[model samples]
Target: MNPLLKKLQELTTKLDSTSETLDSFRVFHGRGKIYPGLEFVTLDYYHPVLLLTLFNQPPEHWLNENLPLLQENISQKIQTIVVQHRYAPGDPSEIVYGELPEQVFAKRGALSFHLNLAKQQNIGFFLDIEPARKWLEQQAANRRILNLFAYTCSFSVVAIAAGAEKVVNVDMSSAALNQGRANHLLNGLDKNKSQYLAENILKSWGRIKKAGPYDLVILDPPSFQKGSFDSVKDYTKLVRRLPELMPSGGLVLSCLNNPDLDDQFLLDIFNSACPQATFLFRLPAHPDFPDAESNRQLKMLVFELATG
Candidate 1:
């Protein structure tokens, strides 16, 4: 047998059904892999890709083994691995397993992700926004929050944890919104305090504006979306318009995932568009992420904006 197949054959077997989302799958504690109660299983739809997860070990070799491949191909860096539970059999689903790009090797606890079983990409949470997550956790308590482009609602999870009185998550994808809903449930957030909205941001701003005058708003749009935006020329316009939705002391958590644009572009946009909203700080990027000099193609920026 080949090395890969040989590795799989070595795994010990365990079986159980997933009550939360999936029906069932057999679990394997591969000899060389990590965890006891932890398991590796695949979903029916995406079994083509292996879902090496832990009900019980942290993510290991999968990411560490693959980093060289990712880094060699792109200097922009892979800060986290977004591992989603693949629904199909025999596929490459381990690539993006977390919101962050690095293969984190914590000696304790099983690995987990915010990405839902249904989303195509492995990214459950936006890993690049790790620090921003902590930032939100710190700032959002007791505030009225809105999350735009709220994929899987990782930001909402943090905001709710931070004690936000109410959080409205807006997204275009029903699947994505559903995942965010799941997250709110996962974190045991109060049902009455959180709300989910499925809408197009550019067109739904009227509704958003009414719901807002928010104390905290998160804007982490996809780099380029098909129906709603072309992040290149139109992103600044969106940034410019957000001040209308914010209260004087409200904070906007603005993020740009497009690496092609430089940080200076974001600085310029903030300078010109929301001049009244003080630029509190740019949250620190993750450590595992490659240095900016190594990357020439990415422009991921997370900023703290407060309406002064």
Candidate 2:
């Protein structure tokens, strides 16, 4: 048996047991674990498809030969297989096996969101942010939300599902925001209660602030977007303005995905910029995507502004 196959099976057993309720999740994240530069996940599990993403380097020729063995050995009944290369510039994801669907929906709790698995860099919804979604649902009741870099508005769906009064989703991509609007419609959430702003967040603070005095502010941004955001340098700028957007005693769900920066990077920024805002806790990444180093995992810090 191939060593990778054996490890995959073992990991699948552990992940599948607890993930029966979930329709989309990371089956493996092997950045510095089971395999270097490889990630394997099952998306739209209800539709039943597998996605294999390669990072750090291009895939070896052996992958074409070995993927079949992998598909045969896996426990789930995967109808489609897609492969994406993270570092390859402008390279489109390929459907390695079976047919690619026009649309795929994945369930989390009672809500379902569309997943874009073809012709894009991202599959639309991020599986690793499941913990934050769960947390938001628990605390979202009757609160106003501002979701920054709101890719496809997955968080908005969670907020709406959890009875949020209103949500504003801001992203630079009009296409993404349109998809977000569709997601809200798909879940039958009131479209009037949500606003989709398609503008550069940093430049549109004047516009964003108008919708604010928000009860819960959620920030989840890309690690690096050329000419847009550089986490180490630009993240602090967003942190400095937190006080202006959120009201006293409001909650802030801040997320950072840059592996190079540790949790303290965010903690220190929050502590310094908004001294009154207290760090509540770190949201845990799903167990299925464990990292050998906790700092490298997706970091979500819940902070509450001080009440006067």
Backbone clashes, each candidate: 36, 0
- Decoy 2 TM-score against native: 0.89
What residue runs in model 2 are displaced by over 4 Å at the alpha carbon?
A: 1-4, 7-22, 36-46, 56-60, 74-76
lDDT of 1 at 284: 60
Query: For model 1, how does the per-residue alpha-carbon lDDT over 3-57 read when each residue is reduced to its tens digit?
Result: 3323333221111222232211222223222332223421111122234443223
Candidate 1, residue 195: Cα displacement in angstroms equals: 1.3
Cα deviation at 166, candidate 2, in Å, is 0.4
Q: Which candidate achieves the best TM-score against the true structure?
A: 2
Over the stretch 236-292, how does candidate 2's per-residue lDDT look in tens digits?
A: 888888878875659889999999898899999988888988898998877866777
The all-Cα superposition gives candidate 2 an RMSD in Å to the true structure of 3.1
Model 2: residue 251 alpha-carbon error in angstroms: 0.7
Instruction: List per-prediction Cα lDDT, in the order shown.
Output: 0.56, 0.79
285, model 2: CA deviation in Å? 1.9
